[model samples]
Target: MSSVIGKRCVCRVEVSRVEWNFLHPWQRTPQSKSTGTAFVIEGKKLLTNAHVVRSATDIRIRPHGSTRRYPAEVLYFGPDFDLALLKIKGEQEEIDFFAENGKDHICSSGKEPDAKRKKFLHGLQFATDLPALHESVHVVGFPTGGNTICVTEGVVSRIDFLGFSKSLMLTIQIDAAINPGNSGGPALNSEGLVTGVAFSTKSHKKNQPLSNIGYLIPIDIVKNFLGRCQENPSTYALSPIIPYRFHSLENKSLRLAHAVPDTVEGVLLTSVCDSMKGFLAKGDVLTGIDDRKVSNDGQVQLRGDETIQHGYLLRGKFLDEQVRFSVFRNGEHVISSPAVLRYIPTICPRWESVDYFPDYLILGTVVLLPMSTYLQCQKGCGTRLSASTTNWCQKWPHEWEGKEGLVVLTEMFSHEVCFGYNRPYWRFVETYNDIPIKCLAHLRDLWEESMEQAKESDDRNGDSNSAKTFSFVRLGLEHSDDIVFEVRAAIQAQADILKQQHIPCPSNITQSNPRYKS
Candidate 1:
């Protein structure tokens, strides 16, 4: 492999982000700095890990062996695939300088060529096929404890669905030393072709003692991200997943109960999303996807003895494309026409706004925020609230069909009006005055409407001298709890509570009503 590949192609990324404090719910830590690696791709874009630039307030990129830093912005980000595309921003002269100097024209010794210069940098080409088992590969990146590009050699150890970014996707496991700054670096094959992008590694456990188990985002996923970016240049279009639980048909009793024949080898569908509720019932068994036959263990055979999770068939195809499925229903082989792949919004999104502050609403003393993976990480799971939130995040409940978003009471400020509500934070607000809380914006609207109603009621009663009372009913541990307070007194105390707590605003209601002021 030519050493100029690393010096001319690989680049270092610097990011500055504001870390939010989930516990305080109102405090934001100072600007935090992080670094990673990226490489130039086709179309004058840079490819890197989504996590590397997540929550970034400012991003700058410096080409290998260059001190000049150029500002960049995220063009597209796919959290599921953990891939992001960035575009460099600056004057034409600065852009042309990096574009010209960062090409593969420079020699390995970091010297400019004495002959004529090449017009374009030789971008790494992706491997046409998946890397074979034990295939030699090289990882190049700017790892920690160094400012220059580093290279590590390894082989493809395994390929399977690995859990990452709160979901499972196809990943290539390599025996490479992947460190902090090595993320988003390209893993090249023996021919110096890009095979994968280094992303994560398994942590060493005292009992497990796992080592040399770094994972890479495979080229298929990278291609999918790039393809989606080409289709939609402004944002990412993630592949739609068929929300269904599959169980192996190896159980004899289960097969007999479903009237499945011994010859039929396919996985049983235990449950499906609301959209597929009618088309595919619980007892239906998925026999095949497209032309691929699904085995009893939910595995699909690819070319030349490669068997992977059947879900990969759907992943490989584009969104809205029809995929034919062979199913066995009522002990008879049935060929379903085709189901169009589409994205279904989860009840709780894994990553909400990647480059901005978490959206929150503060009404009175309650700090309400959306239920997300970030919040779940901050507030450890296993508690009643956390467990319930996690469950909701995994499976969208039929009861929450019309609701736009799930807002949880993350924290509460101590105030005279909210004294007895010591039921702990992270609880989901069922309703406000018997009206279902659709989302954070709806919750804010409900509170403001309730206050207005209370003021009107005070006027109608001809009790101009009496204080207005506002009632807020919430779901409690055993039953419903009524939280009643005087509107004027609560409003007066809210301002003081926000100032004392150093909260920037009472609530972030810009999404719904931009004109709303604290």
Candidate 2:
């Protein structure tokens, strides 16, 4: 039976991760241990949720009913999809034995087979079609209570787009109880085929407890993620957002204003991104995508019985691929040209690369860091600084594409040189030496240049008593109150300040830095 196959396929995964402290930016928190479930897929690979192994320093897997632990390496991870594929390391013989026997072999000599033995491992098959609502399904995994494989029966309650890990993706809501440790487990259909991967559950509100609200990454999304990996094995391509706000054109007044025909049913584009600035104008009616007719409510019929968001048609599309659209523009039905999909850089990047150290720079007592969603969350979200910075963070990348980067003055360590400045943390850096700052790396370059120029000027004058100085403008500060500092004095004091503060380095250079290449 497929249920029996699931029991043999499900495995327990343990991850040891070292999380970074956003407050300090460079320092890391103590190592932490977390457990989740994974199941074998094609190619002898284990599939699991990305969050299960986020920031993981080491990953180990124990197959069902096996006491032996095998090391595994992440081959592919998609933060947006919350999926990760792992290839087990150096346990081919043990894995093969377990695959054939469904348990660890107890040899007479109490010794496992050596490299001479060869065996085959089996993987679970995925359903070719989407599961229907109310279809019987089984949730298999090692839940929080114990390490034993557990199975629960349920029905597919609903299938829709739900927010997971800060991004909206297609999900299947099941009535089964999906608790901690169940993440990355497989949800199998009646035939024992994989329907989706168990992921998130809705939390209960105060005074009200929610039930049977677990969500799974739908099979289509899983397939899309796998296909993307196969296409580009070297680089991870992020899925693009629609880049437009949609509104229903069911109202007669809006329909008449846009000149949409009565026979046409479509949604009105309220706003568009800068990339689509001229090609697709606001107030244009989107009637269809790839020849699929869209409903007034921004939905399209995916199949005979399934109607999904019109955006679903754009899923798994590469950045270079173009999508055809039918639109009502200027009171006429037009077949619009193919528009290529592209990903926009966001202020808050996904936490997929949590293992990486944050890029930061320290000058004298002031700590300069780039503004990110992670940083905003670490600091109070409701604070005046957070609120003000969030507005700019939400702005599309195209709005400031020319700018190299956006950075903020995050912290100020007390020093005699910066005595009366009363540094405002979270204030955006507008300019350095009256020149508009590009990015964090560019800011560092400007600082280096300013210091060198100041030194040259002092040398040209041959004035040993004169001090070398540089100045910068803060976004909210007045021009007359520019923050100024003596470059030579600050440089002299940097070593002492860093030692006193127990800082390992003055800055963590990023790949984007030109110095990194050199």
Candidate 3:
């Protein structure tokens, strides 16, 4: 292990967090503390994992051997790629962290004069190329069980590739002992330069036999992530995908069914975004990308003795970049001009969504929440949703419309207004007062309007005791019978339920729920 790389480049990240309490919608979890590793990079920014700063209220940085900590802010928290960029909050102020006489290299022990905290003398440089398989590497971090920085050794075991922007997920698997608090640390080569960033370990579950197997986000992914950050200089990084799905044409019968000649070998385009409907179609044989010829198994030559999936060629490219794709359709080999792949919507948006707090609305005593990947993982949640609706979009994911989302009737307070209706804990709400429900906000608006209309209807009836008896609002549900509640009684039940439950708000929404657009 190189002493200079660990001591000078890496810094310990301390995070103070106050997370949302999903179980109790209106409340927040207690403040908690966590630590991870970050290293200096070009532009005076620190690089680390997004999970390190998740739900963070305050973040501080302590350079190796320094007792003082400096406050910092996240520049880009890319949860999609599990990476983040940060800088000292007061960098605009007198940034004496680096002395005036400091050297340009990151490993330099540039001495500071009268400074309370040590300055980064230099930023770590990325390797010009990826380390070959079996190359020994050093993992540096301030892992748990110790306060000082710890260095571990490992060998690069594998590097796999596939997909468009998602190809960036193809990380370097290493036989390293990566543990809690080691996240975002750099994997250094013999020259002590950064080759990869430590991100994950295989099978983190207890009782699992997996050990000595960790993964590093390689330089290519780091560079690609940094490149996408330029699209929005002040926000978190997100993976912008190209709407393309290619399947292997490995089988003889399958290739023959697609009308491919015996001499031709390439992958088949199984699905693409609606924007590509006229240009490409399902079952189209994809022959090449630019000048590179694709193989039957969807692989393409990277160079002599090296091969990668054809989509890897497009990994570094931006979403707006037009790619020259060659395909065989209707018995003709066509060389098409550049086509800028479009953004497509997903059916179950909750899966891998980056929301710090999810959007939810309370209708009287009923809780209306949107379906998401995160919601599906909690408390046997996968079964909470009706399989008929959840499976429809999943089975034919391409059929899911843009801006479409599910609004589930996930909860109900133990009030007399909803006493007769079955719990239907995770059933979806399809309509309100006979009007279709679009999203959580839309459902809220409908309920509010229905209450107002019910008030108007009561005014026309003029103070009759019978009129107070039953003006109703109906909520339709999937996999359950309609829930009928007296309008005025249900609205009053909301305040009663909140008071009894110690909830301050009727809903947990800060923004109009974001829908993945077409």
Candidate 4:
């Protein structure tokens, strides 16, 4: 309790709009407002989560005691770290009031003190070394209702190998009471040092009682954020690849899409950074890298020639430099190619651009604009039901066979239109109203047409018809029944039970959808 009582720190945050694709036919562009905390770091810089400022067209920050919000500027951000450095004048003066005085010794320094009172500062320090299992800790954050910071004490219950992100730090865990408003808050050790920043929460079992299991983005990632801030402030590392010799593509046509290599494939030149020495080359048909076998499809796998899938390879490649490749060209096997590490942004092909989706929603479903990469990722396996098409067929490599758009990652039931079909992260949108969805333009056109039809029905029926009308939605499939059924059903049952009691419903339904398509 002592760790919590004094751990509270005041943070002033303002809401900003995050642009997302509208899955519906009626809505052309939609923006969601998200709140984020503003904290002073390194005197001149303000720190917040990259997500706080992601896709923001407008940004403002308010000091803890101020009524007038001041415009703030982003200095640097890294998608990998989910960390952003914001800039505003008078930052030092803004936080000077909370700075500890000379006589205020916040540190216990291992000395046993009175149990009744404990001291903490505005921001805690991260222990360079990780805490042991069951170690005591606390989290300080500015929770939802108001800006007054709150502290919740808990323990380091467990840590697991969560997959990596753009910044590529290994995943970690803590059992602190971190909620939606607690994100970007600091996790602290007994000494009041920051261990990590709260990012997400998880529940271990389905239909099971749960606790405050939170995931923190490790503090060590600050190094990468700092570097990007100084060198490339405009762009964050969206998806950086440390390239090895690409051997050959099983389907040379799908070389970019499949990223697979074969015995007869030509290597990609990738990047040529003069500063990066002894690590890369242009002609290496990569066979293996850092002991990971390089598949012909440009896939890096673990031992026994297993296929290393997803962005996980990006994680391993982040920590190491050189990779050994087994390349065969003209019947010659060469085991060499310096790894090339380069930052490559995720390109939303013009055809698949979010703008193409209908300005609104329809039939409680959102459609996906077919991008070359998305279709390529699909390997042209699923049937195309949407009516739209694109030039991606020409530009995208042959290996894709004719697929587009990466599978949907998530979907949240934000409003009434998506009530019963509130499935999130279930399946990718393959078609819309029987139309073969090809590109963003196609999806958009389909949505507009659907909206017109819905409007016409409303005029004839003399009913508002607004309840079922949708705005643009990010298209994705529903979670697998087995994966989401228990939790969703429990939530539904709970809602019904609460309705019987005349009690208000929970504002936010906290659940993680695990069934994500590629």
Index of the highest-lDDT prediction: 1
Better of 2 and 3 by TM-score: 3
lDDT of 4 by residue, 1-518 (tens): 24442343324556556443333222225566667665544444566777667667677765444445666776665555567777653666344434421124333585533433333333333467655567777676667776666678787765443543323354457767666667666677787666667776665575442576777775655544565455544444333443322334455575644343343443443433332344344444445445555455555433243333323444434323344444443346666555555543222332122212212211222222223334324433233311122322222222233443332322343333345654334244544444455434455555446556655655666654444443232333322331112222333443554454343422211121221100
Q: Which order, best to worst by lDDT?
A: 1, 2, 3, 4
Residues 433-453 of candidate 2: C-alpha lDDT, one tens digit per residue: 667777777877776675677
Q: In candidate 1, what are the lDDT values of residues 1-518, reduced to their tens digit?
A: 45564456788999999866654545677899999999887677889999999879999988887777788888787887889988887678446745555554667899876532332363666789889999999999999998988889999988887568766788899998888899999999987778999998886774452577789998988998788878854456666766677899989999888888889999999877775654567778999887888999998875577788888777666777787778998868887777776666676766646422357776677677766634545534337766666566667456465787777666668888787876645567767766777777787887777668766777786665545344443432212254555565666567878888887887764342221111
Better of 3 and 4 by lDDT: 3
Q: Which model scores highest in TM-score? A: 1
lDDT of each: 0.74, 0.73, 0.72, 0.47
**Candidate 1, superposed: residue stretches over 4 Å from native:** 23-26, 97-122, 204-209, 277-279, 354-357, 378-382, 397-401, 457-482, 510-518
What pairs collide in candidate 1?
none
Which runs of model 2 end up more than 4 angstroms from their true locations? Answer: 1-3, 91-120, 204-209, 274-279, 304-306, 352-357, 373-390, 457-463, 466-482, 512-518
RMSD in Å for model 4: 14.6
Q: After superposition, how far is residue 192 of candidate 4 from its true place, in Å?
A: 2.7
Sequence-dependent TM-score of model 2: 0.87
Counting clashing residue pairs in each candidate, in order, gives 0, 1, 4, 66
| lDDT for predicted candidate 2 compared with the true structure | 0.73
lDDT of 1 at 347: 69
Model 3: per-residue Cα lDDT over 85-116, one tens digit each: 88888854217543321323323355432221
